[model samples]
Structures are given as structure tokens and as C-alpha cells.
Target: MPITSYPFDGQDTTETQYSLLFRELQDTGIADTYGGPSFQVSATGAGMTLSVQPGFAILRGHAVSSTAVETVTLPDAGTSSRQDRVVLRLDPAANSIGLAVLQGPDIGQTQTDTGIYEMSLAIITVDANVTAIDAGKVFDERRYAGSHVGIWTTNLRPVHPRRGRLGCNTTTGRWEYWTGTAWTDLIPGTADNTTRWNGYTLTVSTSTPSGTPSPDRIWIQPTS
Candidate 1:
């Protein structure tokens, strides 16, 4: 005849705080089985230490402080068996527990468009001494009808009045000015220079023609 030992179940232990805690852990899948040791225990005088296996899944605990939580990510494993691991640490003083989660590559969609300055939106003003208005630095007539204008001033004297207009090039980033009839390059070349207009004056005169005249010629003046 063979003798068999029966499993022992505690009768005195009622389903109270400790039993409820254990059941909660078991229900959350943190523990392998009911009435079994769920967390590995380490001892310190200050507080208790609990460690759980990675695959055990969800965790629940009361935090004593805010800074008690700490999380760490694991290294990559391989193709078919990729191991995304997360670790949580709890601290007592801060009354908080740290949590971490792992995931795979992201999948989504995207779009794009290419557009340049199509209309004139602003007026750029430079000084007389400026040799050239580099591309994109000054405003042109086409740019005036667009959205915004940029002004580059380089004149030293406060009262000097020879300010120039900002012009644009159709092919590239270049600006020119209209001196009554001809278009003069305000700044030349690819390099942008100062748009300072200094010491230029405009004169205004009204004359009556033999017949009927058109409108009056308004001249702009610069202080000499």
C-alpha cells in the first residue's frame, strides 16, 4: 500500500485584507496561481521590495510618494522573436510607482506641396549707396501684390533722404530701380548688400501746356 499526502488549506485565514490583496493580484494576471507567492521578496529596514517577471503582465500597488516610479526599456532581440520589455520601479517617499510599455514600429500616411512667391505683396526700400539687392532680400513689383514686404536700410545719417525702391528679377533673386525711364540695378550679383538710400532729393514742378494738361507731376525730394 502507498501513502499519499493531502494539500493543506488554511481554515483560520478569513477572506479579509491579505486574502483580498492576493486575489486582486491573481485576477490581474500578475500572479501565476492563487495562494502562491506572486512577487519575489527582498528585505530592507525602510520598506518591502517586490519583483515580478516580465511576462506576468499588469501590476497594481499603492504609492507612498510621487518620485517612487522608475521605468527602463530593454534591448532589441531579433526578427520573429522581438522582445519589447518595460520595467517599473516604485519609491516610498515620493508616493508614486513608475510604469513603462513597449511597442513596435509605427505605420501611417503623409503629404507635401511646393510653392514659390506668386504675387507682389510688399515694398522693400534701400539706400543710395547700396550696390545691389541680392535675390530674395528685396521686394519687387510682383512681390508687392503678394503678402508681405521686407525693408533693408543701411544709411548712416538720420536726415539723409536718398532712399531707393526694391525691385525684383524674373529669372533669379535680383532687384532694380526705375530712374524715370530706365531700370537701374540697385544691388547686383548673388550677394545681398545694404538697401540704404542716402542724400537723394526729388523736385516737383507744375506747368500749363498750350492746350489742356493732364495731371500734376508730383516729385519726391531728398534732403541734401
Candidate 2:
């Protein structure tokens, strides 16, 4: 029970048209913001399979500074070939290291590497794309809605708990969500000032869940 600009953007519009307009915006919301997280793993072994299921898992650089190592850890993908996302934030100085993500089924599998310009980050969309790019910016425009913060967890499933709820999938490593119609992944990488685990919407909408998400569900996406 609150007022939003979207609904009243103009008065002559019908509710049905507004609903369609809202849906279009909802679908693109996540792409506009970088988001997601999960269980933490260490950056110490080469070709070791971290115990992350078909969901998400975090890989800590431990501020990993060694630049001579040659192997990267991967998840035990087993037989599904299901892509799992990894939210990686290299120690700003994680340069020149033989760093990369193990792409598929085996430890000796293929992998994707990243190029962070110092403090940059990315939301890697796993599977078909095997892509890696800089994290997107989550515009901080919800201060009055409530104070949203970063996420730290041991188990993360279905990065987006509900439809239109966009997020960074540690399992998919990209902006994604279940739209109650289909699963969608947004643009890879992020904009400036997007250094946390939340997403941003293109604009505010009352139809969408804003002003702090439901319990256990955090709104990683923010809007301008």
C-alpha cells in the first residue's frame, strides 16, 4: 500500500497495459544490476572439485596473491552438465596468476579466464556460454526503502527465490532468475560502484517487490 511513479507515470493508461509494461521492465531488471552468492571455498588446490551441488558456491581469493600457480579448482559437475555460477572477487592484486574457472565435467576440463582491471568483478554465466565478464553496477537508489547489505551464506539454491526476483547466480555466475515463465540470464559484467551482492532495477515499480525483499530472500538488484 504505497505510491510509485510507474503506476502513475500517466493517468490514461489501462491496468492491463501497465501490467505488460511492468513485465517487460521486470524481465530486464536483473540485467540492469549485478547480483548472487553462496558457500565459500578456498583458492588453494589445483583441479580439486569443490563440494558444491547444482546450486551456487563462493570462491575466496583469501586475497590469493601467488602468481605462479597453474591450476584452478572446479565443482564436481558429475553428469548433469548443468552450469554452476561462481561469484569471484579476486584480491585486487590477483594479477598474473594462472587463474581460471574449470568449465565442465572433469578437473582436467576446459575453463574460462578473466581480466579484472584491479578492483573489478564479474557474474559468470556457466554452461553453454562459459562466459566471464566484469560485475555490473547496482544503482544505490533504495536508501529510503530500507538499508540493503551484502550476502554471506553456506548454501544457496535457485538464486532467485521467486519470479521476477533477479540476482547473481553463483551457480550460473550471471544475472538470472525464474520468471514464473522461464529462466533468464542478463548481460555479463557490471557497471561502476557495483562491488557487492545485490542487483538494481532500471527504475522503481510497485508491481515488483522492492523496499527490502521477503525474509530469507534479499533484493540484490537495486534501481536508479
Candidate 3:
């Protein structure tokens, strides 16, 4: 049992739950504020700034999708990483070319002295397929044949796109999920959900992952 289990368990393993209760968090709740894409608004490569429609300004996808990235890679392999802490700022009405700024630390490096410098970064307007979402305007994350906005957090932001399902945020190492209306945490190790700790989360030999694990790792016990 942990912070909350009600937020991270449901889906009876035999139901056609159409309500999307397992959409991933588009952005992490950390120091970054990701507000923004259905497609590669800019281009589908490195050094390419992404944009999206107004309402779909922020994007989210399956937490564990193959496209999930830990750090923004540059158009060139060794040129330079977009840096982990850099936040993408956008404003449709800003005159300084898309209200983009260069700030934040370089991750494993000292802070830059740019001091809020503006650049002509990629500008995102709107898309025809994806409907725009206002703050708290509840829309289905997997609705229609369009893209939904999301963040690039460092975990498996899987898109079960259905309601009343369990979800885990690996970065913060917690399990909470959307309850069709709001988010709920499935307090760790509840009832039969027991966790074994031997210096670290241990494992039974011959299982999948066999060794000491990070405390933030999520483990599900199977019932036979």
C-alpha cells in the first residue's frame, strides 16, 4: 500500500472500456511547462521545432510509445542536445517571433547566461483534424483519427485511451490514473499488491527483470 491505489487499478482484463482513462501526461509536473501537437508541425527530424493547433497546443501520447524521448536530440548526433531542462514557450500574439526563449540548465552542466533570449522558433497555429482544447475542456485523448497533444516525460506514458485503468509515472515513481473524471493514485502495495524490498526492490529468479531495482519502478504481481 502506498500514496493511493484507487488511482492505479481497475480494467478487469475482460472489458471493452471505451472511455480513455489511461492517457499519458503530456508533460511532467516538474520544472517544465509543456503547452502545445497532432503531427510533426515543423518536421519529423532533429533540430526541427514542433508546433500544433491552438486547442491541441499541448500534446500527449502513449507513455511507452517508441517515440518517447528522454532528451531532445539535435538534427546532428553530436552537435548538442536540446538539453533536458529547456522549456518550450509559445504565444500566438508575441511580436518577438513566437515568444521562444533560451533558458534553463544544460543538465550535468552549469546554467547558461542567455537571460531569456528570444529566437524565431517554430510557430504553431492550428490543425484541421485535431480539435482545440481549452484548459479543463475534457476531450477524449484517443478520439477520432487525429493527434492529441502531450508532454515528453521520462516514463512509459502508455495510451490505453480507455477509462478506469491503472497508470504509472516512472519519473516520480508513482502509480495514479484518470478515473474517467479526475486523477487517482493506486496507493502502492495494496491488499495482494505486495512489494519485496531487499536493499532495493527484489525479484524472484527466472522472472522477467531479475535483480535489485529502482524504488521508483512499478511491479505488478500476477494471479494464477
| Clash count per candidate | 36, 26, 36
Best by lDDT: 2
Which ten residues in a row are the worst by lDDT in model 3?
28-37
Off by over 4 Å in 1: 1-17, 20-66, 76-81, 87-224
The residue ranges of model 2 lying beyond 4 angstroms of the native Cα positions read 1-155, 188-224
Per-residue lDDT of candidate 3, residues 1-224 (tens digit): 55422233662531112112332333311111122232112332333233323222221211211223222222221232232212233222341212132322222322122222221223222222333312221121212222333333334454443244455656656666545555456684433333455544433333456555665555555554
Model 1: residue 146 alpha-carbon error in angstroms: 60
lDDT tens readout by residue for model 2, 1-224: 97445455446765435544643433211121223221222233223323211212122221223323232344443433343333333332443322345343332322223223121122122233222221221111110111122232315634444445455656556655555666566574545332334443333233555455544443333455
> Among all windows of ten consecutive residues in candidate 1, which has the lowest summed lDDT?
108-117
lDDT, candidate 3, residue 166? 52
TM-score against native, each model: 0.15, 0.16, 0.20
As a whole number from 0 to 100, the lDDT of residue 87 in candidate 2 is 30
Error of 3 at 13 (Å): 56
- Per-residue error (Å), model 3, residue 169: 19
Identify the leading candidate in terms of TM-score.
3
